[model samples]
Target chain A: MSSQAPETTQIHNIGYRSYDGPRLGRAYARRALFSQSLRGAYGLGRSAKSKVLPMLLFAVMCAPALIIVAISVYTKADKLFMEYTQYAVYLQLVIAVFLASQAPQSVSRDLRFRTVPLYFSRPIERVDYVLAKYGAMASALFVLTATPLVIMWIGSMLAKMDFAEQAKLFGQGLVSVAVLSVLFAGVGLVMAALTPRRGFGVAAVIAVLTISYGAVTTLQGISYTTENTGSIIWLGLFSPLTLVIGLQNAFLGAPASFPGEMQVGAGTGAVYLLVVLGLVAACYGILMRRYRKVGL
Target chain B: MIATESLSKRFPRVTALDRLSLDIGPGVTGLVGANGAGKSTMIKILLGLSPATEGSAQVLGLDVRTHGPEIRERVGYMPEHDCLPPDVSATEFVVHMARMSGLPATAARERTADTLRHVGLYEERYRPIGGYSTGMKQRVKLAQALVHDPKLVLLDEPTNGLDPVGRDEMLGLIRRVWTDFGISVLVTSHLLGELERTCDHVVVIDGGRLLRSSSTSDFTRTTTTLAVEVTDSDAHPDGAASLRAALAAAGVTIHAGVEDGLPGAGHVLLLEAPGEETYDLVRDTVAGLGLGLVRMEQRRHHIAEVFKATDQEEVPAR
Candidate 1:
């Protein structure tokens, strides 16, 4: 490297200078909002205090996969102890907790602070705002649900399991996780958007997830004891968690893990699939309308 | 820079803006109206954030109806309410806003720094907005609007909560936005005097209708009134009364100044000077009354007088 003084010297004035550079259009603006919102979901660009909860929940989500891996290695098992598709079922609480804590952080802060008008006044449209927020929350949930499946797949590989069989199961587990992430994100974002207060948003999301699951499971249990097999299929459709599990069992040919080994038959699974799509679409409809009238 | 025709916005219960039409050109134009006089409503329609019920509008030659995103790309807006987030630093917020306006990441950062500095926020730009004073918060709001370097900026009650000195500084910055950067500004305020000094043109609307729209100089043109003040001494204990009597007896048309104490002067009297000889006539008349003359100056009309006069004209209609 030759060290020579530069011949050209220019002093930039410190006054207001016009910007004549290239400006990306609406698509780029929408993408920027998506990236900002995704980072915000994980509290990446926020203060240290805001980072603690989401990070801790993420760490807690990964712990069970690590322990399962250690148990398989120690036991010298021919096959892994847990099924990849069934992992989310055992850790539903962690997933629900993560959704409860992070969903409000994504949607509620803008409303509570009245910053929605700032976004609307720019090049981004109202529908763009809703889509960006929903996409970010879903991507955050996707990461939350997919990391453990990858870890378990890696563990099975280390445990000297059959590669072809493990790959097929892992692929199926990923599909199920993708579907679950979408459903959960829709539910959580709609709940958060309903209230401007962060605390209320968190509570509403948690209450919807846990209370619906509890009520559906209780109703299923009662109906099963009374030998009412017909209502068991309908009762499981009310909760989001049960609906996803049914979709997985019916469509992916996975074993039924519901209470009492209840089989999710072909017909019930079809209805579950329809309901899931319907619920997600309805959530979008509500979010679009909700953001339209707020902070104007 | 902005034009509207027969614009009307109606809610279920009340009409916010009714058959309002305006034509504004470049430079700093002030939209003067009281609260709920549809200033904010008009801004929303012009920005295309809310649809107008009846009429069409254009900003920077783009139709607000079909080209909302296009118009917003070239325009910046500072809302009236407190809209800054509390937890983020001003720099972070402004940078994000710049990105929202379609600037790339690097340009957004660079523009945010420059705009924050221009708004007089230095080291404090990195601090969280929750700890800032009202003046600092207002600056942050303004910096976000200017970061993208738009061709037009709409400011809504920028001096709503600022103290006297802060109000002056903010107004000076608004004036420079037009002078130094050549960005057209449409600032709204209820106070007429502040706009008299800051705006090149002023538009006054009342009850969702235009009251007056003219240049600031036209509103404050020189009048035929003379303001006279006399010294109150022991010899002439009531010098203002004696001077008023003398001017009236001499057939000079005199009007009363409030309490003989207008804002910056003492014991002043207002008389209509129809011709050139009214000055010499008043001098001789004050000397004959044995009162010392304090000040005798021609008075230029203030915008407040225009506002009051229109207000009186509307009283009978109401």
Candidate 2:
């Protein structure tokens, strides 16, 4: 047999060139985003069915709502079917729980298990990872909360309700899901980013969603019962859930508006949505910076 | 090719790597260090996963700090910990990982199969990794790293929790990764001996500092010491005793007691040879006595000795 080549080779003597700075950064970011999307798709579509069965169970339970709309349209309950548009408010609560359960684990799992290093080793950027995670979370929440709402809207449409009334409810449902999903996604991302441990992250999400919001709502309730409308609206701003609810109540024509007899205008509600968006953006920025510093 | 210039990393309360500089060329470069000795830190920095607090590092002529993705795409990593998603099978996981690395679906599946087979995991690849033994899990990790067809692989403690047989198998597989596929490997182990046998070059670090970095041959080279073994005869009850006495009387610097048994049988003696001529002299001396020369070999410095020398020099600051 011919002699084998040398087993060892010498280090190449070559001058180093500076990295293509912009290109490197972009590539890193792109990889991060792709990985994040892949992770979300896998977790939500594959894993979450077992882990977050309650969300799926809720979806199953909502089947009766569809049948009710069907029965109402086909028979004597068409008006009740039209009135059922108000139940769109319940999707917000479902979304709150869905977002709360998933947000804490998204980034926290990587940190807790020390898998961040593996992620960084890939051709993905830190910013992309954060954004991808956020996007994935938002997508999951949308599926859980928005999908059912859309289905219900379609069922209402198929029930042959008045076109004018159907148009009004459909517009409201779309806006409601958009605002609520974003809010839930924002809170979840912030809470998850704040802690490396999944348990603590989950607890933080629950605390912010339930206790903090509950406290604000309770104080607002007492203030409103005492006819202190200004206190109700200000306190309502403290909880996105309550602000959405307050807006919904205003839209559905409730008497004695919470913001001191002032009508709940779309402008003020838009400002609340803007504030929520701002908070989400701020949280995203913080998480991205933190993950960048965290090596593996 | 990889190079680091005083690369350092400091945690909140501890410094993991402290100004370590080394050049790693093609072929397998074994990074040997005890737990918490900055082996993982160095790998992370090279992969651009972790940034160094001071100094710079480059891999494949690309800066690690900014060009992490480009480096990672070209470098595969088999992490130290068990990070497999418990529910996914090795095939599924590796394929998914390959796809994440930008492989097309068909190519990812094909590459995954090829990589798993190369790592010696065939039918077992179908089973979820959670049920796999530590060795099997390790092989899956290796398969995933290779699935994307990276130019270099950084394997952190690949044989961390394997039996002797499994460790040997893993080392052999690592060697094949380089020899068969031409993939350069940067494998780490706390055991220096393991690396000495498998790596082309060895890098030793202690307490986040570079103790030594050299070719395996250079690390093994030292003053010549010969071990001679002779088959014990029925007439000569203690063959090693006779050989040691005869060698000692012949002006050979015999060290310590004669070790019982040859390479396969009989008794052996340790002799310090002054030069290469001593080997011929010892052979003639043993054969001149009409004794069966079972084995005669030169002994190199044991890797443990180097660690001992470094350990005795200074106690690293925790």
Candidate 3:
């Protein structure tokens, strides 16, 4: 054997201390994920490029209300040109665009980059991830639906309308916003979660909203010509927007606005509410199942 | 710090992990294997991100099936692939991760800043991660894993795309993760040579089966062949030939052409040195023959030699 001596080395101390601090468990995890996802839905914590679409779409939702308010205040008109409850329906395309663009911002990007592994490796459960995404999407839609109503309220004050009538309309419009937010948010997030590709997710959400509207209008046209009343009540169930409007009309004791819903009597508010709950539950179930297998 | 029992995972047509069991203590351990060796699968099971098809596992004494949330709260994971979202800055992403691990809001920001600096990311942490280089992206991924100060970190192929210099830097940082912070680490790599210098122990596997698990020194045992060279001089002409003859006469087998044409001898002689006495016998035999011993040393095995140990028999995982 060759004669060689063993060498010894000393360890140096470069300080990196252990953390013995408090680590709150599931409740904190839930709140943190929920808040971050809510901000992400509006592109708050990301680059400027990501903020462009949501900001533009939000502006588009407010433009018509602002212009009508300006004309009334300048001319001193006595009545509003547009009702707050009907604005989202008249500009359903813009609302659809907002949902299509923003839903994937929270769900598809995480899937595309495989960032779910980072999320699932934390203290949160898989269902908690799904719930956070749902809450964020619903809140964003609620903001979009409610902002125009608030603008109309401010315009009513500027126009010097009767305060009691305006307050009643505002409360009625908010009930519509609350119901529609849950309905549209459920549909948008589930489609994005299932597709998980941005372009296809966009197409799928838009298609779900528009295609259902088309089918409802066609069935309503057929019923209008035939004068068939029973088929008209059932056809209102196909389109989510029309279905929500029917609930608003039924509960507020207002005249029906859409063509298809005028034939259905105003006594079916309980059935409409049940269908709304069922739709929300179904979408929630699918989203939760999608995430359970995502991190694996 | 980690334990598994009869763990098996199967896809529709393939079994990823087959009855693999391992018990690892607190230190830096390397899981050595080739591609498709079920290394990622085993790590996911340990973290409780994925359930095993059968059997049981635990991390830091929490059962994988019943206590996944608690286990995940304490263990950090650096996944093998590119898993970072491209639109957010590193600071934003790491702070979110820290908060997700149950740190309070102010502490999350503080820990994120400290972790980014520790991972060698300074001003660049403010830029979107989509514009960063592969090495920079890797550092961000590594930083998020450590932001929570977990008890153990399971890193899957941390040096997959790094250059030689970047690889060495990452390996040094991993070693320091254990030494400076006293956290346990289980790192995986398909390449075996790199782990020899970094890991205190190594567990080798193939085709979803455990082949061997032992300390790095034990797996790299001293081999039986001794390489001997003698100086050819005036006092002893043909020194290599005389030593070969003398060692053979002293009841040692000599392979006459060890590196047959080395410049110091006409040929280097190889001798069987299985015990300490055999080394002494070689020195005495060469001295008696009046030949100069140039060099004589036992051959040390490489990590590649461990692959052949699988063919000998199945070794239960330790």
Candidate 4:
């Protein structure tokens, strides 16, 4: 059966090289963070239809409110500055609601689905994951937080409102949005970090932002009525919204509203900024540490 | 190449992976363990998806703890569970994953198409994965893992929910992923037989601890026991019992007969032989008895033998 014999093959020289160096600790962390952010972009792009629908819906809903504010500023050109500033404050409330709805889901969904392992397996460190997640969520929130302020500024200029007043309000709004974005991002990160479940994170964020603040303000109001004291001045610092409102009052030369009295002071604004910074720092620290220890 | 040292994982009540150490080299390495045997945990630790409570691991020369991403970039992973987004089509999801691994947009798209075709998805890749069958879904998962063209791939129970035919097909594709593409694979499965034909190395674990880790050949090597089947006839023919007695008288250890469930249903005798010429001896003995020799072969150890051996060892210890 063997008309032709099968020939045996000979082996050739095999070459190999080895790598040696210091362990890639922090460098790997940086790579991991970049990859995680890229993963976030990939995840969002994969679910683009679902994510884009909600974003577009929000944009549509806000369009009418933006137009109304623009029309008011165009018609009453003298008080345009005041109206736009007030409108910005109302827009912050919408930003708060949007944050409450979206931020928790963004963090909690990964935990619920046990998909954090997918991200952890990448070249991204835990800190990088947290930062990437925060960035992704903050980017989403910026749509609501920064877009209205930008619209109002553009609308004011087009309507030919008082240039000096517009400039002042624009500057204030810019600072306000920056502070608000940080505050929202910190609060959201902290709330999501506290639990891996989506429902609990959302509920926790809502409680901190709305229920806890409402209860504290009510208690402060009662204290003001009964004791007739000004020591409760720091009560606004207990809630992020109140903190923002207090800073806004100080910066715009508006009357600062305590429980019983209205006053104006630069000292209160500094205190509010300090408190926001403290919270953001605490939230970031806790979030990074928690993420590092998280199982997946 | 991968190595682990005293790797362990502890939960609140149960330890998912006990103090287990192992080393795996190039080629297909099959991780076999029952559900909750820490196979997934080991894969996660190796992938840097989850950190071990103690000990250390290295994958492709990168530390699992710190350089997980770097390791993951070089290694691909196909998770055991259903983690695919329902809305996205396979082509879109895999392409997006390829890009996420740092491929350019065009390269990602091209690779995604090539991987999908390689996995046999074809036109079905365009359909939303929510409607995919288990086999199709498995292909999508495999496509995503290979789309990045990684050096190694960790496939966690890639044959989960697959029928025997589907399992064979998946196993064939996995072997091709190594042989055809020259990529190393770390595939996990609950069934050892599923991997016996595919993998070069086998690592077995139970109760969160390693039981055995060796080459598949070492585990499946034939033992010095002959399984013989003889034909019983009406004319002057003795049954398996008579043949067993005849073999026993001839200084051969006749362990069991047809009723002992060696191989065939009837006239099969399990003979314990001391040397390698057991098959020839059994054939000569059966021919001398005037009984037709049906089949005589060495009894190869099944993967199930390992489980039985472990059970026996545990019984004696207890």
Top candidate by lDDT: 1
Q: List the residue pairs that clash in candidate 3.
A: none
> Residue A240: error of model 1 in Å?
0.7
Ranking by lDDT: 1, 3, 4, 2
- Model 1 DockQ, alpha carbons vs. true complex: 0.72
Q: State the fraction of real interface contacts model 1 keeps.
A: 0.77
| Docking verdict class for candidate 2 | incorrect
Q: What docking grade does candidate 4 earn?
A: incorrect
After aligning candidate 4 to the native by TM-score, how far in Å is the CA of B90 from where it should be?
3.4
Q: In order, what is each prediction's RMSD in angstroms?
A: 3.5, 7.4, 6.5, 6.9
Which segments of candidate 2 are over 4 A away from where they belong?
A1-55, A61-68, A75-86, A104-113, A152-169, A189-207, A247-262, A265-271, A289-294, B8-19, B230-242, B256-267, B272-284, B287-294, B309-318
Fnat of candidate 4, please?
Answer: 0.23
Top candidate, metric DockQ: 1
Output the lDDT of residue A119, model 1: 91
Q: List pairs with backbone clashes in candidate 1.
A: none
Candidate 4 residues B31-98, lDDT tens each? 98888888888887888877799999999988989887678777888888766666568887787566
lDDT pick, better of 1 and 2:
1
Q: Taking chain A by itself, what TM-score does each prediction score?
A: 0.94, 0.74, 0.89, 0.75
**Candidate 4, chain B, TM-score (2 decimals):** 0.92
Q: In model 3, how well does chain A match by TM-score?
A: 0.89
lDDT of 2 by residue, B166-213 (tens): 999999999988888888999999888899889999999988999988
Enumerate residue pairs that collide in model 2. A28-A124, A28-A125, A29-A125, A32-A124, A117-A296, A123-B69, B261-B266, B261-B267
lDDT of 3 by residue, A191-241 (tens): 998887899999999999999998987887788788875666667777888
Cα error, residue A176 of model 3, in Å, equals 1.1
Number of the candidate with higher TM-score, 2 or 4: 2
